[model samples]
Every structure is written in structure tokens, then in C-alpha cells.
Target chain A: MKTLSYFLILAFSGGEHAGGGSPLDVNPGLILWTVVTFIFLLLILKKLAWKPILKSLNDRENLIKESLEKAEVARKEAEKLIAENKLNMQKSEEEAQKIIEQSRELAEKLKMQILEDSKKTANKMLEDAKAEIERKNAEAFNKLKEQVADIAITAAEKILKENLDKAKQINIVDKYLNEINKN
Target chain B: MYTGQELIGADTLKQVAETAKKTDTSWIMHDVLDANEIDLTPFGIIHLPHLNLFGFDISITKHVVFMWIAMLILIFVLKKVAKSYKSSLIPKGVTNLTETLILFVRDEIAKPTIGKGYENFLPYLLTVFFFILTCNFLGLIPYGSTATGNISVTATLATLSFLVIQIGGIWKNGFFGYFKGLLPHGIPAWLIPIMFVVELLGLFTKPFALAIRLFANMTAGHIVILALIGLIFILHTYVVVPISIAFALFIFLLEILVALIQAYIFTMLSSLFIGMAVHQEH
Candidate 1:
């Protein structure tokens, strides 16, 4: 390698003087140096620098992506839970309204039952009073009839004591009763 | 270009060597074009060893020194970021800069351009990006030569990518199939030979252009900045120095932009070439 490079350099530098010392002189040594240095740099830097740097960048990107996805999942779950709670709250309110409507119906039925019972009692009392009044009226009428019959017999005795015989008087009273019935 | 800077530097060396001679004057375009020496204008040339390890000149050039410097800076910065990764996923302080640039290259350059199986080519993409960028930045700082501006350096880089493109193509499509995919469908039988030649030429020209584009961009920006600064010397007046400095400063700022852009273009094109080879639809 050293002999190869030594000869290469002599040819380049020797050729420079021969070519009248132009600044555009091409040297084999500089070319060798450049190639060697670049390859060295590429190999060394690839292992030491780029590997970890790119890895860390990739890792950071993955981390951020995972965190964002987790946050999105959490947000969706929270929204679902809120919706469930709202639905439950609405369902309970509907049940409460239904119960109130049912109780009102029961109260109305009870009021109607109480009114019917009171009205029936009042009608029965009025009927009982009427029956009692009718019985009293019948009693008074019977008593009056007895009194009138007695008075009539006394009057007949005083006016015509020997005029009419006992059998005839009974017959005349029967006839009067028949006439009253016919009229 | 370093050549422009080295022009002034070379003559100064020549002037010192012949101190008994009359003073040297003025930078010529020829000097700027022909300078092939080390550039250390402020400091006298420090003679680096030119030992023959075997038959070649094993002497280090200014560009190589700067290349090594760029490499060290990269290793230092990246290793520091690597250390932070060991502790935590989140980067801190200067490590953030390293990671941000790395991710930008991966996401913006490699991932979209290479599409599926981008990870396999990531190390090469990252290396080329940071390497070219660091070399370009080193040029902007004081006393640092642009290694990427050197034709040989850029060519070496292109050659590596070319190997990856071909080898990957062969690996994916088999040797014959890889070559077969080079030709477009529905071409007449008579045109296949001509088309194949053109396609083969295109394969080489693509990477060739990649090399030249980076070398030319980096070299051109520096040359423009140097020329702007050299204007004061050319005009031989203190009056124009302020204006020259102003323009030079503007171009220097612009060079900074060009350096980064050139590095990005090099890496982006490399990934695209690799993708073409791997997919082989074109």
C-alpha cells in the first residue's frame, strides 16, 4: 500500500512540474486521501452517530403516537359513560311521572265511591221518614171513625127512642152503609 | 481560487529566494493561473515532509490538511451529538444544530429522492452531505483551503458515488439486466447501438458533471472574491480599496451561500443517481 501510494504521488507531483505548474493539477495522493477519509467517516459515523440518533427519533415518534391513541380511547369511553348516565336519568324521570299519574287515578276512584255511599244513605233515611208519616196518618183516621160512629148512635137514641124497633134500626144502618159505598 | 491567493504567495517566495534581486511587483493573471505551490502568504512556507513511503510523494498538501481539519470538525461535532443521544432523545445546545441538519438531509434529501429503502443509503448520504458542507465551510474561515474546490477531491467523491450506483444496480438488476435497463423502449433496432453508446456516455457524464459542478462553484466563488480584493492592488490606489473591500465582503457573504448550496446539490444528485440505479426504470 505504501509503495503504491508513493509511486502514485511521484507521478502526480512529477507530472505537475512537467505540466508547467498549473493550479488545476490533479494529484493521485489527494484522491487517495479523500477516498480513505470519506470511507472512514462513513463507517465510523454510521455506527456511533446515526444509529442511536435515528433510533431515539423513531422511539419518540412511536411514544407520541401511542399516547395520542390512548387519549382518544379514553375520550370515547368518557363520552359513552356520559350517554349511559343521561339515559338512566331520563328513564327514572319517566317512571316517576307514571307513578304520579297512577296515584291520581286511584284517588279519583275513591272519591266517587264515598259520594255514592253517602247519597244512598240519605235516600234510605228519606224513605223511612215517609213510611212513618203514612202510618201516623192511618192511625189518626181510625180513631176519628170510632168517635163519629159513637156520636151518631147517641143522637139517634135521643131523637126517636120508641119510634123505630131494634131489628129495623140495624137494617136501616146496613142500608145507609150500602148507599155510602154505592156513592 | 486558492490559485489566485497562491499567486501572491508564490512570488513572495520567489522574491525572498532572490533577495539580492530588485523588488518583485504586481500579480499577473498568468501567475494566478499557474500557481501550484502551497499557499501561506502571511507566514513563510512551512516545509512539510516529502518522504517517499515507497515510490510516491507522500508529502501532504494544503488541501489535504484542510480535508483532515474538516473531517476532525465533523467527527467532533457528530460525536458530541452522539454522546447526547446516549443520555436523552431530545438534543440540547449545539447538538441541536447537528441533529437538525442530519434530519433535514434524511427527510429532505434521502427519503424523498431515494424513496423506498432509503435507510440503506442513509450513511453515504449523510456522510457526503456533512463532508462536503464541512469542507466548504472550512474554506470560508481564515487559513483554510477548500478541499472540495480541488478537482481531484471532487472527482474522488464522484467516483465513490459512481461505484455505489453501478454496484447497487448490479446487485438489484443483475449485471446484464442492469445494462439492458439503460436503453429506452420502443427504439428502432438500427438505433440501439447508437442509443446504447449515448446512454453509456450519459452515465459517465452525469457523475463527471457532478464533480465539475461542485469544483467549479467552490473555486469560482473564491476566485471572484479574490479578484474583487485584488482590484485595489491592480488599480494601485488606496482610494479604491474601500470599494474593493465592500464588493469583496458582499461576494464573501455570497460565497457562504454557494458553499452550502453546492454541498446540498452534490448530496441530492448522488441520492438521485442511486435511486435511478436501484429502481432502473429510466
Candidate 2:
């Protein structure tokens, strides 16, 4: 192997220096030596070097793959949580809209009920006022008629210039009261 | 003594220019290293024509010294990183960072392809990946040699992967079973011989593919940076320093990215090969 390496070095250097010959003008001895050396190196390395290096690389690869899988699963879980939150928000919004509509309807119903009640109350008050006025007028008229009859009786008694008998006066007054009462 | 100038001469430079004009294999190097020569003393220190230290010199070439330092850094850094391993504790610092890479190769690369007994192959795959990656990256430094830029280096690395596939397959499946396994299951009796030949050829082709891919990618990036820097010299020798530096730096940064990509591709392909061999279904 060493000889092969040396021959290759010489041949390559030669080719580099002067270049009229074919590229394949290789020395067989060097080729053989190279082959032998390569095999030797391979054996030594296999025994002493490769195991540790390969092990480290494999460990790194596995570590990377595992981390990637974990990240993927976590991302999926986060997405699911976000979706659930969005659905809940949509449901709440709909519920809030329903509640607002119900309250509006209630307010409208209450307003209409108050309007109807006030109209009924106002009609009742107007009817009571008319009945009260009629009662007062009738009382006043009856009292005036009684005062005029008393006054007319006193004046007739004075014009006759005679003392009227108590029984006949009583009888005339009763008869007049009865006639007024009847009328 | 081996400075960049010592290795290059007017005649050699002329030859280099001529080669560049004619062939597809020309390489470009910008004036990043203000040295006379690219030295190999550091790599040549321990292993030479003979592995012996005759005498030590204080004034060694900087590039050579730097190469030694780079290799030591590669070794020490890797060792230090590996030393941090324990059964229960979490890996820390450089160890932790590398541990991650190790695990990747074991689980994603070695284990998946090699199947039930993948643990056995983890060490090999991890080493190959790191070794090649380190070598490729080191070359990106200014005045550095791309070890993988050389076909021999790549071929050797490829060969090792090839050997693992072959030997491991043979061990698991048995010698006779290994050969028989190569043949397609549904081929007619007459066509079995032809199919067997094709299958045998296919086995060899996989490693060759590995070799070419790594070598080309590593070499290509350097060439691009070199070419970009060389543009100022080729187009106009004087008064183009700023423009050359800007383009060169831009490509140099791009080369860093390319360096990493090439390393990754090499490792991935090796793992795929192991997987193919271990799992006979395909």
C-alpha cells in the first residue's frame, strides 16, 4: 500500500510536469501497492476507528427524529385546543344574541301593556267626574225651591191682615209641600 | 536544501508549459508558497530507502517539517479524540463531535449494509472515512500535497475497501458460497458461464470506481485553484496581482467545500459497497 501511494505520487507529479502521454500511463507496481495498502488501512480502521464515529452519528440522527415527532404531536394538540376555543366562542356569541332578542321582546310587551292600562284608567276618571257634577247640581236646585215656598207663604199671610189659624196654616203648608214634593 | 527553486528550472518550466499546452493532465499551482522547492523530507524521515536515522539536522525544510507536524496532528488529534470514550459518560469536546460521526458510520453506513454483524466492520469504515477525509483536507492548506490527489493513495484506500468486501463476504458465506453467490439466481444453465464472467468482472469494477472518484475529486479542486491563480501569470505577468489573488482566494474557498464533499462521497460509496456485499438480495 505504501509503495502504491508513492508510485501514484510520482506518476501524478510526472504527469503534471510534462503532459504528452496518455492519462492512463499508470505504473502497475504502484496500483498493486495501492490496493494492498488500502486493504491494510481498511482492516486497521475497522478494528480501531469506525465503531465510535458511526455510533455517534446514529445517536444524533435518532435524537433528531424523536424531537421532530414530539414537536409534531405537540403542534397537533395546540391546533385542537385552538379549534375548541373557537367553537366555544361561536356558541357564546349565538347565545348572547338570543338573550338580547328575548329582552327586546319583553321590553316591547311591557310598553304595550302600560299604554293599554293608562287609557282604561283615564276613561274611568272622566266618567266619575261627570256623575259627581250631576249630583251637586240636583242638590242645589232642591234647596232653592224649598226657600221660595217658605218666602211666598209669609207674604200671603201679611196681605190678608188676619191672624191665620194654626191648623189651617199647617194644612195649607203640608198641602203645598206635598204638591211640591209630588211635582 | 530542497527549496521550491531547486526542483524547478527554466528547462523544466518550459517543458511544463509545453505539457500544459498539449495534454489533459496539466496541473496548476499559484505562488502561495514562496519557497524554492516542495520538499518530501518529513514524509521521508521515518520511512526512506531504509528506515534508519543517520544524522539529525536542525535546519530542515519548513514544508517538510510542516508535513510531519500535520501527520502528527492527524495522529494525536484522532488519538486524543478516541481517548475520551467511556461506557456511561457522554462524549465531550472533539471526542463528542467525532463520536457523532462515528455513530453515523456505524448505524447508517456500516450496520445497515453489513447487516446483523455490522459491528464487526464499524472500525474499518470509520477509519477509512476519517483517514481519507483528513488527507483530503490537509492538502487544501497552502503548499500542502493532496495525498488523495495521487492515484496510488486513492487506489490503496479503495483496495482496502475491496479487500474487506471480499474477505468479509468469503468469511461469512464460505469460499465456494462466495463464488456461487456472485452468479444471478435465475440465469439459464447455458448462460451461467457468461453471467459468471460478467459478475466476476463486476466485483473488480467496484473498487476501481472508488479509486477514480476520490482521486479525480481531490485532484480537480486543486487544479481549479491552481488554474485560477495561474491566470494572472498566463494572461499578464505584471500589474495583475490583486485580480489574481481575488480569484485565487475565491476558488480556494470553494475548494474547501469541495474537499468536504469529496470526502463524504468516498465514505458513502464505501459504505454502500459493504452493504451490497453483506446483503446478497441485490
Candidate 3:
């Protein structure tokens, strides 16, 4: 066997072409060993290496799915918040508008009330001034009528004194008055 | 399109030599070995360029080394991740990342399709996604082999998905009920046999489609990037630095997207199949 191995080694080691060796010609034993080792390793990997590894991967996938679901819920909540904010804003705007209208109505009512009171007060003052002026004019007219009557009586007395004596003059005046009445 | 060394150019030889020297092979057959000078037209591995092995010819090459390395990485990464889950709720760091993906597959992919009480199928779905993604991403690495790029690998994965769908379906419904679920409710009696044949054929066809879809998608991206890289080589023939830089950046971005997309598509299709199997009506 040693001689055969030496011969085999000698044949292979000869100085020959550089690029001409077939794979089948070298290391048949090594090839067999390699195949067997590969199969064995495959079995061991399946048992010891792959099982635990798969579990971890499954865990990670589950984690990702859970996180995605949480993100979706958060997004929905944010949308609801935005919607609520818009609703509140609209409600406040409507309330503010209503308050402004009510204030304007109150202001208009106050202005109308002030105008009505001033007109009533002016009417009362005008009536009082007219009554005072009318009373003053009536008093002046009475005084002028009294002065005219005094002047007419004085003229009549002067005419009678020149015509007759005092007692006879009275009788003559009465007869003249009676004659004037008959005529 | 070319699987091995037939597509190798002169510069690819130099790269292979540099890589081989870096691997620290203390045993040397010859004192002076300029790999660039060696003629490689005779070997079938030439279809895959820029690939070489330590001390072999016309067989497995650096791409195979990358494949092996990817397998080792898958084992080591899975082991470390599994070990981290000893005490706590779940593992942290790389374990945590893997664990999240597993859960995504269980909850998003398997649960929706497989219906209630689908947690039991998480193991199988997680296994399929990680295993396929690992293999698919392996090809995105520089000088890395995409095991899923091979039709065989995709076919195997698709077959497993098919098996699971059937098994799960059978488990959910009884043996007879499972088959009966295939036919729609309104089919006339005369068309039942024909529909059964078509449905049976479709059952196989679904996995076949899965295999082709994954294999084509994974392989197409790599080939496009390889071709783009090849453009620089063809253009300058010698100035590979700038071209490599540009192509690497473009391919890196594209590969990252491709890696995620491939993982998603595999998981989606698998889930769809499982869903169809379990709940045939909806």
C-alpha cells in the first residue's frame, strides 16, 4: 500500500501541463468526508441554530405589527382632535356674532328713548313761555283803556263850565240831553 | 459553457503557477517549473480557464478546490452558528443573521403555503434555503466554484423539494386524499383520467422546472461575468489589471444582487410548491 501510494504520488507530481487537472482525480476521500460533514452540519444547524433564530424573527415581526397598529390609532385620535377644534372655533364665532347684535340693538333702543324725552321737555317749555307772554299783554291793554276814559271826562267838564251857572247848568244839561234823545 | 481547461489562455497558466506556488507545496518534482511555458491543449480541463491543481494534470483543478473550500465553509459556519445557541433565546452575530433568515423562511414562505401548523416544516425549508444559498453564493466568490451552477446539484435540490412537497401533502391529507386533491372540483367524469395523467406528469414537471430554473439562473450570471472579464483579456491580451478591476467591480455588484435574488427565488418556488401540494384548492 505504501509502494502504491508512492507510485501514485510520483505519477501526479510529474512535470506536466499546468492547467489540466480534473476535480474527480484529486481528494476522493476528502470529498466524501466533506459531504458527510456537510450533511451532519446541516442537521445540527436545523436543531440548534435555526429554531431559536426563527423565534426571534417572529417576535420582531409581531413587534412591528403592534407598533403599526398603535400608530394607526394615534393618527385617528389626532384627526378627531382637529375636528373638535374646528367645531369649538365655529361655535365661539357664532356666539360672538350673537353678542355683537344684541349690543347694537340695546344701543339703538337707548338712543330712541333719549330723543323721545328731549322732545317732551321742549314742548313743556314752549307752553309755559306762551302763557306768560299772553298774561303780560292783557295787563297792558287794561291800563291803556283806563287812561283814555280819564281824558274824555276832562274835556266834557270844560265845555259845561263856560255855558251856565252850577245848579242851572245841571238842569240845562239834563234838558239838552232829553231833547237830543227825542231827536 | 466550457466546463474546464479548453478555454485556458497563456496568462491563465501564469496565474495558476502563482497560486500553486502560494499554496506552500513543499514537495517538488522538478527544481525549475515555469507553469506558463507548459502546453495544456491536450487536457480537457482547458475549457475552464485560469484553473490549476498542485500536482495533477487533466483532472480536478482550482475550481474544484474552491468547491471543496465552499463546502468546508458551509460546515464550519453552520457549526459555529449552531454552537452559539447553547444557552439563550437565540444565537447572536452570524447565528442571529441565519436565525432571522430561517424564521423568514418558516413564517413568510412555509407558513403561507403549508397552512396552519406549518412550523414543523421550517427545518426542511430552512435547510433548503441555506444550503442552496450557500452553494449559489460560493460561485459569486472570485475563483470559486458554484456547486449549484451544476445541473446535477440543482437537480438534487429540486428532487428533494419535490419529495418534501409530496410527503407533506400525503401527511396533511391521507394517501388517497392527496391524489384526489390534484383534480379540481368541477372536472367532468370523462375528463378525470386524462386530467389525472396530466396532473401526474405535472407533479414531475414542477421539480424539473425548479431544477432548470435554478441551474440556468446561477450558471448564467457567472458566465456573463466571466465573459465580461474575458472581454478585457481579449482587448488588451496583456494589460489585465485595469480590465480586471473594472470587471471585478461590475461583477461584484451584480453577484451580490444575484445571490439574494437566487436565494429568494429558491425559497419562493419551494414554498409555492409546498403550498400547492398541501392546499390544492387555494
Candidate 4:
């Protein structure tokens, strides 16, 4: 089994130095070159590639963060504006309601004033008509009184001329007038 | 130092020498390293003249060349993305895709693991992730070698991670405090030494695993594919061709997933280690 294993190891390992020599053999020159090459690569890449790439990555990250923050701020501002607009709308609605109320009150007061003025005018007209009728009746009665007195005078003059003396006629007329006034 | 063909040729020469010696014929023998059936040496595909400096073998290998190509590709693509990123705030095309990867490393890996001090180590994590990913993917392409498959390369990366973890800890907590924090408080004095050793070993084991895991995973896929192809040559049969090719293709697809996963694992672990080191409270 040990011999077979050794044979297998040898066969699989490329039949005695197939891929290269003993894999353990270290070449000094290669080592030096690798070190120099790697260091050179490190220095060059550090200066040229990595710095810019890292910076750009960081910059992009910051930019994204800033933009997100700005968006958040803008959203807040919009919300505030909407709230303010809603408040203003409510305030305007209230003002419209108040104006409507005021106008309604004014209309009611005006209607009342007009009714009172018309009532006053109607009452004054009624009183004036009553006074005018009274004055007309009094004038008519005065005229009739004058007329009756004049007629009586005329009749007495006629009768006296026909059959009665002048002094008796004057006394009789006075008594008659007094009796008529008393009746 | 031995190329694959040279190694194979030496094997042939050795066989010839052995036969000749047995047959009582004159033959030349040269000392050579045992030739592996699959010579995995990262050399000899394209002859690059060796240049030495300070006693170090700096001869560029196939893996090194591929690594350079991967680096150039990464640089070009990332630079273009950087330009677009700089010019316009909105990411487009390649920039968009690359940004997703970058952000993943930062947010998922670095931030979650490293916490507050994630920023300091992010670049290193990003570099390691992209570099390893690029290297792993490049290997899948025809004629491309995986630099990450090399132990030396992975070891170097692991060492870097280890260094960062240590340095970050020391920097965050003073030197004495950092080492002191390794041992849990309220432990018995006798047991403290054992716990300290265990903790010290734990520190090394983490990076060691990082290196071995990446190196093995990356190399294993390539070996499987190579072995599958090698079956055709070994059997010398047309029947094996379709089977080998089909299996290789399957493994190749799986490798793409492994490539990304390994890169992620490396980066994630590195960050975790650094996070642990810097913030010892947790």
C-alpha cells in the first residue's frame, strides 16, 4: 500500500518534475523582482488609481445623501405651504360667512326702518285728513249760520214793513233769536 | 540553470551512457541533475541573455516576463479608468467595472476586516488583489506563465503581508505592547510561555499558508492541464487526444474561478491579519 501510494503520488505529480522542478525550489531573482514589482504597483496604484476612485465614491455618497436631505426639506416645505393654504381657505370662508351675516342684518334693519318711516307718514296723513275735514265742516256750519241769520233779518224787515212797528220788531227778533238758540 | 530541453537531452545522454557501459562500448558520462519528466523551470522558452548584478542571477525568466506584461496591462487599464474617473463624475465602460472591483475590495474586504485603520492599508490590498488576479489570468492564456505559481513570488507577497501586519501592529501599539499583546492576559505564568510560542507560531503560519495556498492552487491547475496533455504523448494514441483536450478545457475554465478566488483569499487574509494586529482588542 505504501509503495502504491508513493507511485501514485509520483505519477500524479507529473512523473518527476513534470510541471516544474520540485515546487519547493525558490528562485532568489524571482523573489527580488516580485518584491520590486509589487511595491512599484502599490505605489503607482496608490497615487494614480485608488485615491481618485475612493474620492469619487465618497463624493457620490455625499451627493446622494445631500440630495436626499434636500428632498426631505422640500417635502416639509410643501407640507407647510399646503397647511397654510388650507388655513387661508378656512379664514376666507369664515370672512365670507361673516360678510353674509352682516349683509343679512343690514337688510333686516333697513327693512324695519322703511316700515317705520311709512307708518309715520301714514299716521301724519290720517291726522291731517281728520283736521282738514273738521275745518271744512266748521266753515260750512259758520256759513249756514250766517245765511240763516241774514235770511231771518230779511224776513223780519219784510214783516215789519207790512204789519209791525220798528221798536217792537227789534225786541221780537231778539226774543225769537234767544228762544231759537235756547231750543 | 538547466533549461528543459537541456535537461531532457542530458537524460537521453545518461540513458545512452548506461547502455554503452553495459554493452562494453566507450561512452562519455557527465554529471547532471536528475531530469524531471516535466521540466518546470521558468527558463529557456525565449533566450534572454543573462545579466548579473551583485552576485544575483537577474536573468529574466518566462514568469518574470509574464509578470511585466500583467503589470503593464494593469497599469494601462487602471490609468485609463483613473483618467475617466478624474474627468467625469459618472463612471463609464471599464471605469464602471473597475470601480465595482475597487469598491468590493474597500467595502467588503478592507473595511469589514481592517475597521477604522482600513484606509491606510487599502492601497496595498488593492494592489495585491489586482496584481495577483492579473498574473493568474495571464497564465491561462497560451504561452503565458503564472508568476503567482512561483513559490518565490508568492513568498515575496506573503512576506510583504507579514511585514505589514507586524509593522502595523508595532505602529499602532508600541513595540513592547505589540509583542506583549500576543499572550492573553490572566493566563497562568507557567502556561504563558507555551501560549506565547503558540501565538508566535500562529503569526508565521498565517503568512506561510498565504504563500503556499496561492502558490499551490495556481500551480496545481497548470500541472493538471499539462498532465492531461502529457497523457496523449505518453500513450502515443489518438484516442487520448479528445479526452485530454476536453479535460484540459474543463480544468482551464475552473482555473478562471480559482484565479479570482485565490486573489480574493489573499487580500481578505492580509486585511484580516492587519486588522487583528492593529486592533489587538478583538
lDDT by candidate, in order shown? 0.78, 0.64, 0.64, 0.81
Reference-based lDDT, residue A126, model 1: 89
* Candidate 2 TM-score over all chains jointly: 0.54
| TM-score of each predicted structure versus truth | 0.69, 0.54, 0.51, 0.74
lDDT string for model 1 (B168-279, tens) is 7888889999999999988999999999999999989988999999988988877777777766765678999889899989989998999989989999999999889888
Taking the candidates in order, what DockQ does each have?
Answer: 0.22, 0.09, 0.05, 0.21
Candidate 2 overall Cα lDDT vs. reference? 0.64
TM-score for chain A in each prediction: 0.43, 0.49, 0.47, 0.63
In the range A44-150, model 4's lDDT, one tens digit per residue, is 88888888778888998899899999999999999999999999999999999999999999999999999999999999999999999999999999998997887
| Candidate No. with top lDDT | 4
Candidate 3 CAPRI classification by DockQ = incorrect
Give the better candidate number (1 or 4) by TM-score.
Answer: 4
lDDT of 3 by residue, A20-94 (tens): 332123333333333443466557666665665565556667878998999999999999999999999999999
**Residue-wise C-alpha lDDT for candidate 4, range B1-282, written one tens digit per residue:** 357756665666566546533442110000011111112336443455565789998667666777788889988899898888667878889988899999999999999998997899988999999999999998887656688988889999999999999999999999999999998878999998899999999999999999999999998888788778767766768999999999999999999999999999999999999999999988
True contacts kept of 2: 0.20
DockQ class, candidate 1: incorrect
By the DockQ metric, which is better: model 2 or model 4?
Answer: 4
- Top-scoring candidate (DockQ): 1
